[model samples]
Target chain A: MDEQETRKAVHDRIDQLDVPQDLVAAAIETGIDQASGKQVKPRRRRHLGRWILTAAAAVLLGVGGLAAVNPSVSRALSNVAWLTNFYLHHDDHFNSFHVNGIAKSMDQKVTSNGVTVHLVEAYYNGRTIGYTGEVTGLTKAIDPEQDWVPLDLDDTPAKNLTSSTSNFEPTKSGFRFHATFLVDKGEVPESVLLPIRISNVNGVVGRWNFNINLTQSQQKHAIQQKPYDLDLPGGEIIPVSMTTFASGAEFTFRTTTDGRYGFIGISAIKTAEEDQLIDGTDGYYASLGITHLPLKEPLVQGKTYHVVYQYQMKTDGSPEADIVGADIERDIVLWPAEQ
Target chain B: MELTLKEITWAQQAVAGDREALGQLLKSRGDYLYRTAYLYVGNQADALDVIQEATTQAVKTVAQLRDPNQFFTWFTRILIRQAQVLYRRRQKETTMAVPPEQVAPMIDATAHLDLLAALQVLGADYRQALQLFYYQDMSISEISQLLDVPEGTVKTRLRRGRSALHDQLGGNYYG
Candidate 1:
């Protein structure tokens, strides 16, 4: 059924469950009586009660993570895994939820179906971000004709910079590094990928770091492009240079006649499924959290661009990565400066 | 003007510790407040407790109110807050086991199992949002204000929750 019909039915059912009359009277009386009993006789000389009350209220507000520390409520909502997983934004121009995690590397293998896909088979590390792979695509329901579908936040992929809790601020934690590219036409921009490892090398032991290897796609969506610089809302932005690492993957620039050197590299590869992906299952859709998106306008001819984020092993200022003793190099490269 | 004078006289008498005037005021509003509380907690017993607690708290607090005309919204807000507090507290401790006592009642006797299954399937946000908006007859702005979220956010929740509930019910929501 269509969306409007669905809403009407639920609204109707809720309407049918009316609260009995006697209950309302009891509730009002309780409120009035409760208010009357709280009047404190004004102390003629001492006046320090208000400050104490404010301090106590502040303490109550500072309790541990409202969801995790509260067990009973979690159990009540336990059946709702997808809703719980999404970043709950109580305020935003367009309602949005974000999938956040830091992975050293994700495996990449593209088949010859002409449909390039990122096969995420593992839920390990943190590559397991989106609610469902089928629900993916910045705007389209993975399968548009399905009798079942997902609620898309917007028809475009937004560079998310918000978190679930208002006071639970976002920190420079858990991200290795990210790369971004905006696709356009004329010159096809190569797929941006990076493989990251998490093992600490500063004589540090015990915690297991990670190793990720990324590959680029041969399909080209560009005809002409230019060097694009991305500005992120949080964390630092660095430049990539011609450098050789242990795996023989070097990040360098493709200099044009104008003397501007653009960048190319791998970002992630996937070999396993994430915690929740759209696999045809009976109750799975209800339980599965899928990120739905649709591109309203088709990719600009000869002007398609994408931002591939590059991450480091250390998160939240944790000095776990020992690469050249620098905070694992986090960088971004836009394939074409012009489209 | 006459009714205003009457209300003022009653308020003065109530403030002066006239138990009868207080009783009249309590009886006048008791049922309405209880219904609001019931809509929030979704349980008669819990609703009763919320009203009792809010009543006690309001009694001690209302004497300090400047404008008693705001009695309905102010009192409703308190009851809503009390239910939310209990819901939050309950979430923490019942992580592993949620007894049937806490679930919403079945809508139909014959379709009890199916309805229970449907409600169980509906996400907490959707069910609660639907309950508050449709069952409680609260205004969209009221729900958003009470929940400390933007009005648009509440609309999105209602949309999503209703869609999911429709899926669970195996037909268009209009059914």
Candidate 2:
């Protein structure tokens, strides 16, 4: 069909699209009450949250963010919270850490009765991540009165919201970097073990590290922290007005297992533990006072070594209680550091 | 308590816990959201689910909206997001137990799908950007405001969305 014919066909079909009755009822229920009061000065979306998290891990693992130095085990450390995703695949030459996965969703929505949120992933196989996914549900577009830092998708910020705009530029997305690129991938090391810390209402539950470049026998040696501290990867904190028997605490913290870019949040839950963990603890960091190890050319890959830290925790001694330990493991591959 | 009260009564009653006003608002725009959703999702149930979520999100965040005139665009973005979310969820459920081979294959080779199939080819961002630019007949600036993207990024997405469509529709790309 010609362009005009195709346009007509598309237009014809669009007009015929029937809107569901119940859906109309639901949206109409929204009644025209607009949000116009308080203004929130929108800073660039939070990126340092990832950095602080890795710093927390460095405090835990003793090596302090050196896992990226080893290229071999980089994939193993990239495992995430529950869905267990984002395996980094690298060709012989380390240019980009190609990540692929069938993006998943937590189909948690009810009719006009309940609401489910979809978080948008920034990048998928190197495509611009759209505003879909549960993350979008977590963010509210700033009210117009509020000043917003033009979105910088990369891990940096320079402002894009100007008086007028142009067409065709990477910065044009009004986002500086693709969301995925916001967390730059580290090179692969021969073997790397990053033990990360997580805190919860139960106290600081535990620390788990991903050991990439593990030998067949070494995979089992991967560290596993029980009672998965939903707050390990610290997130935005919203004060709660109510609590329940099953849910009594704000449990959240940080994670370094997923490399520099692995920042996760628990938006809402049957229990507030996950939500507290993600939204809380943005200002937390164990003051790095002790002398960190300084010996070899950094924790490079293929060189096995154990990391040990002397740290303290909150009073809870329960399995989910807060405590600290030394990071001990061996034999890692060293990923070349980019000069 | 009056006849006119039933129709325009929502203006105030909705704020005072009047379920009728809530009911009226839903009755009016719910279908609109679902239609926009269906365009993106192509599934009835998924589209309906998207509408509900979009409504709820609107309730929570609409307070931040400046004027009511932008509700369509604001809620459309939400509906589009809802459709994308539903599609992702359905894709996950449909593949829950399917082994590696039975799973929905990634769009590696684009030569096999038809025009409609090609519409399904572009990822959510690319497809939405194209639809907004052409089907919606929205100017680049309008697309930017709607998509919350910079205009240049809007053009890039439009270009890529068009190219992907071309590949999927046997080199028949429409912007």
Candidate 3:
């Protein structure tokens, strides 16, 4: 084949592969939503969140809390070990869930090619859906640092799925896996069908699929909600209804301005006693629509925390990273102390 | 490969934080992006993942593109980087039990199977240069700018890649 023939062949070969237009459109919509800060990118590496929380964890020390880890489920199979370990070693982000009793036991299992993948338990708090499971039957232990567990949701409702972060640990039989899938859609359905597929296990290749049902947790209700009017520079007084939860806070506001405006990030959430500096997760940055902020520490009851945010011109992609309570014109929404 | 006036307008609007315009721009280039990603990853699922990730990055950094006419090149660069990231990450996990057919999927290229195989055997750098130069209809300078390499380096890769393909196919494939 000559150069022309080769070019035609290359084009023809690439064209042979079908492009799913629906999926592509969905991805574009998702990307726009995330870039505009309607939602966060699904999977975040979280090294920064963890490192910043090291100090918050120290401040939260001796702040005793309690709630029973669901007693009805089999303690042996439903390995909440991932959550327990995360709370113990990594950070106290999951401590609120543990205290709020927000986990559901999903003791489902699928086995293939001498391997068993157990979908043990799941925690769904409106915004995030996390799963912890066990994998038995491996030739050798997996190094979680180097090896990735190929557990992924299949393509039926995958368009709604944004990002997922997973962790694996070596077990005697195989390994245990913990993964969290972020749902960016504002109104999450009562139940979502997660068709999980594991394409590869160690060097053993085969599809180990599981159709796990995820029901949204009822405990996600706002413990405290209040209406506060935010005065924008353009003389636009946007009424923001802030809802605080054990997980984080949700800002529900509508803007009718012609100028492009979106909720970027909250710089600080302050109380009479403590001023907690937030990583960008505290709020989604953008020009319009609802913004969900996952807070590092749960709001303390009977404490009036002042959630202060400043509107600044977007420098790079995430200006929230550099937000350091600089003396700029700011907006404050008062969350009157929870009684 | 030339940018149309409408596309240029959409790119400008997209960069100016117009979601509708951005969505339109992405839909226009969606197929091309998918094919490019598929070329690197060699599968449907991974290719889709690459596109989605690239789309997210594009939306995040579209403002960084100073030239609206260069949207295709800019987005392609993002897609290629994502494809490489996923390809390298998954290379370690895939096993030998998976048949070659499953990896590349079935394409009706009975006459061009040898060509495809030869292209696959070429090193990553050679394959990229060849694909950009031939399939993407890009000049050496354009390929150099996209790949962030000197124009001479791209020309060398194209020459060496053509020689390698000619040696395999037993003809002047690049003539």
Candidate 4:
């Protein structure tokens, strides 16, 4: 083939590969949001504690927080207090893995300038890294008016790491904290030394560094199947794949055609008897794009469940250009009978 | 594809802070950007990611575009950089089990498939030069400005890249 033939061949191959119209619309909307300075920021839940600190906070605070609290009960509770505290106030997902003994117990602690930060326990499932710990003996008083940076983690291992922290429930001395980090790209190593540096506690600059070892659990239970194609309006087909992990269910949508932008959200997951699998008390999302829905418990085998989801499509960049929105329900059986 | 007159007008309007025009312009050029990104990243998911991020970056920094007509060049430059970052990051990853796609015979001896496979094995710098010169129909001067490399370097890379591809494909020669 000559130069002209080569160019034609290159163009022909590239022409066969097309990016879905829905994704293009999403990208354009993201761009417009940036240009208009209307990019939505992720909300951080902090200082809005509805539940008061009970025996759990005193366990971390030691003798300083609650005077009437028993020292014997505090020492007894300190060992497993962070675990129960994390489940009660923070995430229900951790309870699923912790109950299965899929977590590593850690008692690593660091002290700096009359303050102490403990790394209690860590849980990893090859997708997310979670920690439940506490900070005690903080000299600065808790102020609702001022934003506090109780911890600063050096997330060098995964540069695109996205993290979320639970509310700092202030104790008499300090507060008990929980954090979860997610690396979106490739799978992290089986064993990793996560370097965490705590500084600017209550706006005071002090470096308290610790290298916490996190290991991916070998006992994780997960199931995934071949892609299931969902047909939409205007001859568009989206291949949706489902993966159920011990902690949650992840739904990944594979684009198949070109037409318009689309948004999908999972409203609820319910069994055949209408038993809800997600905790209603906790905040569940009507997610955008691809997302993982954390369940209260894993779905049982040979059981039928209804996944109620909402979808909307947009043909243009304008907000008013949305073409259709509807709720659809899909029935799926885990480990279905052999065909 | 070369920038059209209407696209140029949109770029000028986008620089002047008209977000709607910017959105329209991005929508129009989305396919081109997506294809270019796929060439660099070698996957659909990462290509989409690169396009989305590059779009956001472009929209946020459109005001810095002194020459509105150079919007494609500027935007393509941003996209290539982002694609490279993701590509490099993915390269560092190690999987325990061999992926099925890697083991399978991915390409036949067809001209397009052979060229694609040859391009995939080429060095990053060579691939970029060839991609711009052939796929995007860009001149050496344009590529030099976009890559911030001297014209001589761009020409040499195109020569070396074409030679490498020719040797791999056995007969095909890039212009």
Give one digit per residue, the lDDT tens place, for model 2 in B1-175. 1224443454345444554554564465554456567667754444544665665666666546564444456656776777777777655544223211111111221232244445655677887887776566667898898777899999899888877877766664463
Give me the displacement of residue A94 in model 3, in angstroms: 35
Estimate the TM-score of every prediction.
0.31, 0.32, 0.45, 0.42
What is the Cα-based lDDT of residue B63 in candidate 4?
A: 96
**Model 2, range A178-277, lDDT digits (tens) per residue?**
1121111221122221111111101111111111111111111111222222233322222111111111122222223222122222221211121111
All candidates: DockQ: 0.12, 0.10, 0.18, 0.16
- Tens digits of lDDT, candidate 4, A195-280: 45554466444445555556553333333443333455442323244445444444333332234545555556688778566533
Ranking by DockQ: 3, 4, 1, 2
In candidate 3, stretches whose alpha carbon ends up further than 4 angstroms from where it belongs are: A40-199, A202-339, B92-101, B104-118, B166-175
Of candidates 3 and 2, the better by lDDT? 3
lDDT of 3 by residue, A53-90 (tens): 11121112111223223333223333555645543443
In candidate 4, the residue pairs with backbone N, CA or C atoms under 3 Å apart (3 or more residues apart, or in different chains) clash, namely A22-A260, A22-A261
Model 4 chain A scores worst on lDDT over the 10 consecutive residues at A58-67
Q: Over the stretch B146-166, how does candidate 4's per-residue lDDT look in tens digits? A: 888999999999999988987
lDDT of 3 by residue, B1-175 (tens): 6778899999999889776997898788788877777777655566667877887798888888898888888888888889878866765555433322232122121243455567766777898888888878898998998899999999999999888988877874675
Best-to-worst ranking by lDDT: 4, 3, 2, 1
Residue B113 in candidate 4, Cα distance off native in Å = 53
Model 2 chain B lDDT-worst window of ten: B99-108
Error of 3 at A313 (Å): 50
Mark the 10 consecutive residues where model 1 chain A has the least summed lDDT: A280-289
Q: How many clashes (backbone atoms < 3 Å, residues ≥3 apart in a chain or on different chains) does model 4 have?
A: 2
As a whole number from 0 to 100, the lDDT of residue A206 in candidate 1 is 13
TM-score (0 to 1) of chain B for each candidate = 0.63, 0.65, 0.83, 0.83
